[model samples]
Target: CQPGFFKASASGEMCEPCPAHTERLGSGALLCPCTDGFYRAPNDPPTGPCSGLPSAPRDLVATTTQLSAGKLLLSWTPPEDTGGRTDITYSVECRRCEGAACQPCGEKIRYEPASAGLTDTKVSVSELDAHLNYTFTVEAHSGVTQFAAQGTPRADRPPSTSALTTSLHYTDPPKVTSMRVDERTSNSLSLSWAVSPRPRAQPRPIRYELTYRKKDDNLDVTMYTVLILEKSSVQINDLAPGTAYLFRVQALSSEGTPGGSSMEDEYETLPEAHLTQNNTAVIFGAAVGGAAMLFIVVVVLLVRKRRRNSHTRQGPEDAYFSSSEQLKPLKTYVDPHTYEDPNTAVLKFASEIHPSHITKQKVIGAGEFGEVYRGILKAPGRKEVAVAIKTLKPGYSEKQRQDFLSEASIMGQFSHQNIIRLEGVVTKFKHAMIVTEYMENGALDKYLRDHDGEMSSFQLVGMLRGIAAGMKYLSDMSYVHRDLAARNILVNNNLECKVSDFGLSRVLEDDPEGTYTTSGGKIPIRWTAPEAIAYRKFTSASDVWSFGIVMWEVMAFGERPYWDMSNHEVMKAINEAFRLPAPMDCPSAVYQLMLQCWLQDRSKRPRFPDIVSLLDKLLRSPDSLKTIADFDPRVSIRLPSTSGSDGSPFRSVSEWLESIKMSQYSENFTCAGVVTMDQVLQMKNEDIKNIGVRLPGHLKRIAYSILGLKDQTSTLSVFAV
Candidate 1:
């Protein structure tokens, strides 16, 4: 209260107290009172304590100078006047542009408030266009009052041109002049055309587009569209023939003009004879019939001219088989190789060994061609030996019989540990059983699985070397085991491996240069090369590829190739440049060798000779077999015993109780493999008591220190739930 006058006018805001030195002389004073520190004249107006100047912020700063992610941030110190007045709270204001012209900007994105005393000075804004520039300002406040001074505004920016563009601009449809689909043995078709000459003055920057439509579909869907720059040819493959197609092409220039002198064409694919049942039969029949008719007519003409050529021939050794009893075996030998030649003579010779001498045992196995049996052979002056007899199936047609004999003749030419041997034939029943040295273990996969992991790396290397040796022998003989796989490999008790199953195996009847058509089955796609899969063409290289997969099976303890993937998916992954990872137990060098065998281009693949050399080098290196031996499969974790409330026999009492509570327990806890000092401390004293186990006194003291427990505690209440 001012000292100018006594307290009065309680309903009014005018000061009544007057200054100690000055007093109001009139009852009707314009101003109420004066303070002691200042003098007021009689004519002067009275004033109360001056409001302390609102403190200016001592520290104002931007949180992030290079603001990004569509927002800006700022922070500052509160005013110092907060000591006498209520504490100052800060307010951050943001503008899109710089200077005072950028006034109070509305909340662009979101504003966060401080629950504690508002010394907070940070602010952010979003929803602004990317790359747009923005400005910000901050001020302090006390209750409803704001400070007189405003802080200098800070500005920031975000990146410009932020949206992604996906497509490129180009010229239009291509024109096709001629379309020719070849029905050659290859799966691919080559397409060619002649490009029209551009105008003499200017070539009018042009591009070509080629589109194909499936003939089976009536909807306007383009199966393929490609743009070419002046090229007049392309090759299309990976198509199912007999699927008709419609092709269209157009030309477009820089000016976007369409349809110049280009023409559209359409064609139907040749129905695939190999893929159709009746077509295959008819085509095969035609080829055989034509050859047979030509042979018969030539025979008749030769018979008629026999008397006239008697003086020119003059030899009984060259006589026909019908007139000669000793000609049978020769005919059998020559029939498959010379069956198509009209002028060639064939004779069959009966082997002197009687069928009764071959004592057949029980049937051992059966496949597409025949069943195999264990048999005893009574060879002269030699001990009775066990052999495998392969006999032809009952329902085989004459053509199939011819093909079988053809395969037998080819197998007869190959003599190696890797190939099955043909001891003799039983032609009386129109059956043939190949008698080979009997193997105790039927296949390599079954043998390895039975032995568990007993076989060491050296033994496996020996087996692989034996296989490579046999393959090398066959390769030298110009024979290919097209069906090389673990299932086809036999292992003797000595663990010596041998390749068998020569029914699909072949001899290069030609000079290994000519191509022959084979009757297709569901090829062993798991081991086949991509070329063989796509084109049905098998070569020595393809056989090598199959052998590599077989090698993986052996090294991996017979895991199936491409396991768990469908055939289609396997093919897709392979075409996309994916190769199988080496099996877990396979050495890296061995895996590298297998990878070399699986090279996509057949020409780049290793030959059997090179494989033999590489395998030999690996076999000689003792360190190459250094795979970790701890991966034994028989040492599987012992699951918690479900038998009784008692602890497991595999674990200690504490571990058994822990296992009962669904915690992990190691069977080797007491053994050197699992016992450790750290684990001993974690075990409680009560648990140790329950297990009738105890640590050393010093160790116990240390454990007590770690657990923060007295040494005399009776229960584990410290860890109780």
Candidate 2:
């Protein structure tokens, strides 16, 4: 016998086709067995009378009714077929449908008629979300008995009827019961609300619409805005100080329908004079008047006193007295020229110490200016303390000497635990030297490299937190450290990090961009922000960008930024929107913060204080560090080759533009002041025309060249790996 067909009995001489609902697995001389959804009938023919299963449930229907606020009533009909059996039961199951997939309705869903059975055809599902669609399935089953002679069992076989499926949608909007002011400030107020109490079956509002206005203002003056909040509280800002306002909130369903509004509440913004501005103004007025009167009296007295002294003054003495004065020994004085920028006003703030107080020990390191040495400083009746002395080299010009000592002037003003402290300077000596508190662990980069893979993520984060704290301190003082990197940070034996170098630091002025334009300097290309590199616009945000690169360095054990790429290449890559990849095995959270810092728009980057807070949160929750970081090496490493594989074409954007005889626009393509190669590559034909490339021939050349460059980039991508 072939599959699906078999003999009726062992005594049969020939094989016969299997009856309905019967199947055989292989060619054999045995009778077929009853398949699923089928049964054997009593007193059947020798050939076999396997009856097919009854049809699935029919006339299936579902209806939903609004029970009350946030509650819904659902009803369904039973299947029409019972498989010729009276003993039957139905099981109901429900799941939420997100898109095409069905997910189990979690704790938010509840079922009425706790256990769905054959007699209980209708089931009420509560706690349904108004924003979601739910699918419910009902299966019907029958129990039948089989005889041994027939070789069929009657245990509950497959459901004689197919499972019925239906969906329910609840669109009831949520009701907001109460609203109140939680807090108020001079310019802002925080409002919170409570939703009306209802069963979990009721759907919650997706958003809240807040309408507010001055208490005495008319409805026309009211301001309205929507708030999408996961919680019940929201802070409203830009309110007039010392003003009274009335607020009302209404809930919005997922369908964008607004429900009833809550009762209005009154709140008064804190007065600007709450800090005793009136009293302070009166006091200041009185002080100014008194000081003016005193100044007049003092001026009159000085005038009279000078007149009297002038009249009482004696005439010049004779030759005898003049000769005696001239004969007197002249006192020796130190020359001001021996000191660096002695005429500069900043020198007045630097404390000059005697060279005898500092005993130079061993040469510690070398810097751009000169060599640094470990030394001991002895104070009167105090213990000798270790210090680091930064000394200027010999054969230096007056300007070089001043530049070397300028760091002392900058450091002397800062006094923070995270900032390196400056001791006194030894300008009186032959070689000018600056002394600072010594750090045992030297530079942060070297320290991290030496201890790679030894410190936990918490420890690394702690170090970053300290660095950010120091940067935050600098930012608060309106100061920007143009050069911020791991090498500039000094680490102590206790693993505390402090910002040290101030060679390129500058005080920010009042500017909307928070930028300090420099005329000339050697910029740190790899660590500089795009605006700073292109326009010399240095701001605290640019420093934040460099700090991000430093973060990568710390996490990667002082790895060189951009690998072995040249500075020009790094700048080009950054302009093309290519960011550094996360270090191997770096935590996802830390790398995410690094990417945030490297945002193209500096304003979007987090401030130093925000960085400190984020690091603190990460440290507090160490488990977050377990998240694996992802990086696409191909995108990050797709750098434009200096020499094309075909041959040497253009080494720089200027060269490329010059090749097309558009040398007049060379300055436009340089990374200084304006346009860059990356920007040129992304420019459309319209952009080229707008940039004064009016000649069709020139425009065609530029467009075709850009297209060729894009093609070359695509080809390079294949070999990037």
Candidate 3:
């Protein structure tokens, strides 16, 4: 009942001898008999104390080749037991045998290459008598047993032995001469190679190492396989269409020697299937015959219809068509470059004014392209007039120079009053310049910041109305201002706002959505529509999204759109269906328009013309401005300082005013008896003005700042609880 021994009586506590090449210890062991390489010698009773010299190695094997005429390769496993020792060595012994008797072939029995010894399980024996029949024997040796004899020590025990006899000849592995792609489809190919002619010999098994990879791929991504083939062909499936692949083949003989690899060959898969040339020709002929018959019938019908309508009375529809072409759907605008002679027609649109007639004054501002300067332009019949001269900076490449001039070409075609007028260009000068009507005030964002709440809601809405009018005009001409933002708009001394920047504008062709697919460019995240930013789709609808942000800018008096958030964060928030909260004290109606412009579905957003009408309506009804929403100042305006003077939260009116950059009004607050932070936080717009903060901008700033402090206090109290 031991692990390595069994008893004839089932379930009885008796042990019997283990099977051959297997052994076990004492009885009652649960596991089965140990296999070869783990067994020990059996005891006298064949059940207990099973430990001794190792058993003979099992599964002895040998092979020979004709290529090495006098050589025979031998390999075998180690013995089943080492007598409880680990250091085991193997030796290959050979003899020249006649019938039954044999004589040892000593010294002449040399392992291959004359370096391998008994330590190696595999050996190649050479220099043998090729005329004599040979027998090869392998013996396993367990070095230096630990046990000592009780009396006289017995002679060193003979090691375990296993033997095999072979007198076979070796043959060279076949050489693969050339490999090629035999056949190919869109996604699969078959490969075949020719083998060099060889002398006839006994049939032997052969294998091929097939390696393949995509052309230009690194070795790390290369794949290979070993195929035991009866023929010299293989089919590889699931290949990528129109992709090139490299293949190599090497032949391995039964002796495990690999021959030289065939030359690397490249092949490309066939392209996807399509209509054949004959089918296309047939379709073309059918379309031409159908079109000819339809044209003849239409000509005859038109002739008959004209005769029938000639006697009929003219209707109002006829009068409508006779008035002007403007009333009809206008033909799509085309880029001037598309004209046959662009040089002549392009010059007709933009005049080339000489630099000598323009006087450079001083630098007014800097722009992405170059610098802006206020200058005087002197024309033949025109008196000196102020103009903004945008001059290209030095060290500009030819491409940059072309982009600089493109804006002038776009502006020249625009004529709306709300659109910035391009007077002429000074391209002949060392620095190319674009001359346009100058605005006393600069960018709309900066103007809003400087005049925060100085202007009433009506005046701010008017500026927005002007911008919408200009955008509507551009939309009518099939133009898309890709980089529309408050910074691109200009304000004049008369409070007039005009759309200015045209560097990124494009005259779209006849597209249903007015969408212009761009490859890639720097996108303004906070101002860009979600779809445009994610997909590089620039359309009039995307421009509406940007205009929504612009509306927020005007209403918030130039606060950063997504306060303190990185471009990546803004993109993530917008993707998650989050929109910017209403700006501080922003009119509910105006904020509603901004939200409409920011609809996730671009088609749902209103067009520029519709926006203009809505703003005009809101402007007419002044009472609508009173409907304000509860604004989340944290997301709109900059957060107020948590720590006031003396490194603590604001506890008094002076400290709260100082935190909001209104330290100048601190004295006014003290004189108005607003001595505590609570009193200041509870104050309203009129109450702030009564406290001597007369400027609408200052009062509004104070009110919002107080609201922010109140929110902060409530947040702190929640956490305190």
lDDT of 1 by residue, 1-721 (tens): 4334544445566555543434365654545443222233233334332122234555555443111123334455556554234545655545553333544345444343322234654543333433223554455554323211221112221111111111112222334455554442334555666555443335445565555655555332213434454555666676567665555455655533334334445555555664446987889988988999999999999987886677576552233112322211110112235446311211131132357778988998775567778889887776788887767788887655655555555555444445655565555454654556788788897776555445555556667777877776665433556677888789875456887766543332222222233466456667788888788767667888888888877875665566545566567877887666665455667778788888887767777778888887765564776753332111111122234354213224345324222122333245423254345546665644444334342233223332431221321221111
Ranking, lDDT, top scorer first: 3, 2, 1
Compared with the true structure, what per-residue lDDT tens digits does model 3 show for residues 1-721? Answer: 6455666456746565565545455675543444433333322233323334555677777665323335566777777676665566666678887668888877645564233236656776666653356877776655332232222244554447787876544455668999878899999999999887664454566677676667644342123333455568999888889888777777776644456567767889997864467977889878988999999999999999986786476553343233232321121234544545544433656899988889989999876578889999999887899999998889998767766777777788776668998999877568888899999998898888777766667668878998998888787666768778888899886567899887753322132222324466466677889888878777778889999999999987886677655566677878877788887667899999999999888867887889999998886576788798677554444553466565335766765676565788888888888888767767888888887887756776777777766687563442223
The CA lDDT of each predicted structure is 0.53, 0.67, 0.70
RMSD of 1: 31.6
Measured against the true structure, the TM-scores of the candidates, in listed sequence, are: 0.39, 0.42, 0.48
Per-candidate clashes, comma-separated:
24, 8, 8
Residue 368 CA displacement from its true place in model 1, Å: 1.9
Among the numbered candidates, top lDDT falls to: 3
- Name model 3 segments beyond 4 Å from true: 1-348, 505-519, 632-692, 713-721
Name model 1 segments beyond 4 Å from true.
1-353, 505-519, 627-721
Q: Report the alpha-carbon TM-score of model 1 versus the true structure.
A: 0.39
Instruction: Determine which window of 10 residues in candidate 2 has minimal summed lDDT.
Output: 325-334
Cα deviation at 261, candidate 2, in Å, is: 44
